[model samples]
Target: MDVIVETRYGKVLGREEEGVRTFLGIPYARAPQGERRFLPPEPVEPWTGVLDARAYGPICPQVANPLNPVDGFAQSEDCLRLCVYAPAEGTGHPVMVWIHGGAYVFGSGQSPWYDGRAFARDGVVLVTLNYRLGPLGFLHLAHLGGEAYASSGNAGILDQIAALTFVRDTIEAFGGDPNRVTVAGESAGAWSVGTLLVTEAARGLFQQAILQSGIPFQYRTPESAEWFTAQLLDALGLSPSSWRRLFDVPAADLVSAAARIPARDGLNLRPVLDGVTLTQSFWDALRDGHAAHVPTLAGSNREELMLWVARESEWRALSDEERIARVDRMWGPLTDRARDYYVDGRTGDELLTWLVRFASMRTFTYPTIRAAEIQSEYAPVYLYRFDYRPSRLGAAHALEIPFVFGTYAHPSARALIGERPTHADVSDAMHAAWVAFVRSGSPQAPNLPEWPTYDPKRRSTLIFDEAPRVEDDPDSAERELWSDMTSLSM
Candidate 1:
């Protein structure tokens, strides 16, 4: 049976399936089209009558192939929506809000893998949301105004904040606790969670955070963002005076133009360190103990760079000399130790994968661990390492998603987890651990070794596998390799 509940913003209807109630495609904010394309999200007007929220919302604009896009998903500019799933029949359950990640370019709440039905069954209200993406969601102009116009780069992030606001105001009516909320995500979503952690406006909205392989090194400063914007405008032959003309261009054209800007060598349209919404870089905020009081669960997979690195052979093969050039170009002359660790006489696909792994760790995992360390000092922080390798593919990026969700037999299971029974069991165990963590900040599951909260002393972390175990800091070697490298400014 479908149940309709009235929220502070509007009436939302959800259907019950397998003991879980799901409300899909609920608009948290109005569509960001026309003049609102690059601005903060506006509130969705309250509706008087029952609203049918049966189907998932349209995904944000993105290249279909996350790895290499030959053809992309169906495009649209009016995609701003959120979905909610809850186990409660009435009220008072902990809320878990999830942000899907596709490098701020792809994926949506609608993705089958992100289905929150399982989480709902675990006695939590799970919310998934979609935000503006790519150029349409992250463009900054030289119109030169104040906070409203000065830093318009992180429109996607602002949309997320609007979604949180909507939840804070309305989730209670949908059987969720407004004060007891946890914001969790992976990849770009993880990055978004980290961004929200430091955002002044986002403070007090969430009480706990969970980050899975969030890139901690991608913050672009205001100057860098502006420089990227100028480069983009120049490429399109649009004069500085014509900046306002962006309001009229088709959203697809803008995305295509932004896609052409090339993201290699540390240049891309990531969340900028605009002094407005984002006050400073993630590392700075973390080191300064900005989010000291908020409990955190953060970790990364053992082979975070393997999959991404494995595919590097296809990126226009280069010579030995060219390999060094490319690596230097990408990371800009690594330290002698760092250089030897990655490119010490290595060549061909092997060299490329090493270089890719080095870059990936530097870009994503290193910061993730560092943030965990910083947050651990202040709050109860739990750290983990997904080390279970599925036959052919090593413990790769995004490998933990299905495992955490516990959907090993789902349609996309084979593609996501490979066709193996051992993998399925591991996924189930990992999923249970996550469910436990959601229930309580610690990941203490039955039949598992005692998982300890992260601290500078032991530097311990739970390793998820068929035989899950708690290991004492797995990547200390690699982490120390880049410990002295300067953090990217927010």
Candidate 2:
């Protein structure tokens, strides 16, 4: 049977299945086309009749990821939409809004891996949303375009805030509590959650956050952003002074030009430190305890960088000396001490494994630990390490998502965790912990150990493995090795 609900914009017709009601492809903001392209998101106009929301919306325009391919979803510019899943019979349920991750380049709320029925089954209303991606969403042309495009660099994030605003205003009709919204995501999505923490516009829209496998890092200064802008303009044969020409270029042409930018140039399109939208660095806001005072749960996999390392042929083929030299170049004076602490006597594949592990710590783990340390000063922060090592892949990047969503049997889990059988008990534990954290401020899963709040004194963290346990200051020596560095080379 079709389920009809009234949003602030108009009536939306959804569908119900197995005790969960799902409303899909509901626009939260106006389509960014014509005059709206590259500008901050604006509210959707009220409609005259019921909007059919039974299908997932078109994903944001971008080239498909070769590493992680998403098939069967239409892509378009009019993709600023969100999906909702709520229990068939509930009132004022805690809401969990999910932002999908793809390095801010690809992915969408409609990705099959993010199905929210499990969350609905657990009494939490789950929402997954789509935002703009690539140059269309993040390219910084504000200085050249003037005040009219001041927020161009952060248009994607502005899309997210608009979606949250829609949720805060309209979720109650779907049996959700506007006051108990928990925003969460992984990878770039987690980056977005962290960004929202410091963004003035996102304040009070969410009451808590869950950052899975991500931390704050460099946002472009206008100078650096303009450097990228120059590169893009050069790619398109348009001069900087002729920046207005960008508005007329076909979206496909823009995406094609963006894809040609070499990854090694460190030219990943990202949010910029716009003086208006993002006035200060996320690190500064976090360090000064200026972040929203909400309970937070932050964590990363035990071997995050391995996902990339496993794909890089040259990195996998590095000789011990080459690996050591590379580590030295990245870690500075701490290289030798870190090797002694983490890789001393190991050789061959074991040595390679250790090398990858250290790289993961330097690039992913330490940053998350630093974020937790800073965030804990202002709010209760729970830290965790996903330690379940699958047979083929270790506890690598994004390996925890399926487990968190309780969708370990999904085909997408194969690319991440291999064909090995998933342990239901582990998924039960992790998903329950997420539910507990969303419902209350604490992660109190029955199958897992008591997760304590993180503080610099104890540096406590929950280790999620077959047998979950709590450890204090886990991997303390390696963490200390890079303590003096300002940021990781992410």
In terms of lDDT, which candidate is strongest?
Answer: 2
Error of 1 at 329 (Å): 3.2
lDDT of every model, 2 decimals: 0.77, 0.86
TM-score of model 2 (CA atoms)? 0.94
The candidate scoring highest on TM-score is 2
Model 1 C-alpha lDDT versus the unseen true structure: 0.77
Clashes of 1: 3
Residue 181 local lDDT, model 1: 89
Score candidate 2 by lDDT.
0.86
Tens-digit per-residue lDDT, 1-490, candidate 1? 8878888777888787778888988888888877776778889988878889987666677665645342233456667888998885657788889988777776786666778888888788889998888877777753443456655788889888999999999998778989888899998899999999988888888888989988556577677777777777787777777787877767767777877887643647778877777777777787788887888888887677666545555454667668667656765556677777888878776776677677667666677777877788789998888888874447778878877776656766566456786866787677777777777776688857898888877888888888988888676777776666654332
Cα distance off (Å), candidate 2, residue 46: 1.1
What does candidate 2's lDDT look like per residue over 88-133, in tens digits?
9979999999999888888898877789999999999999999999
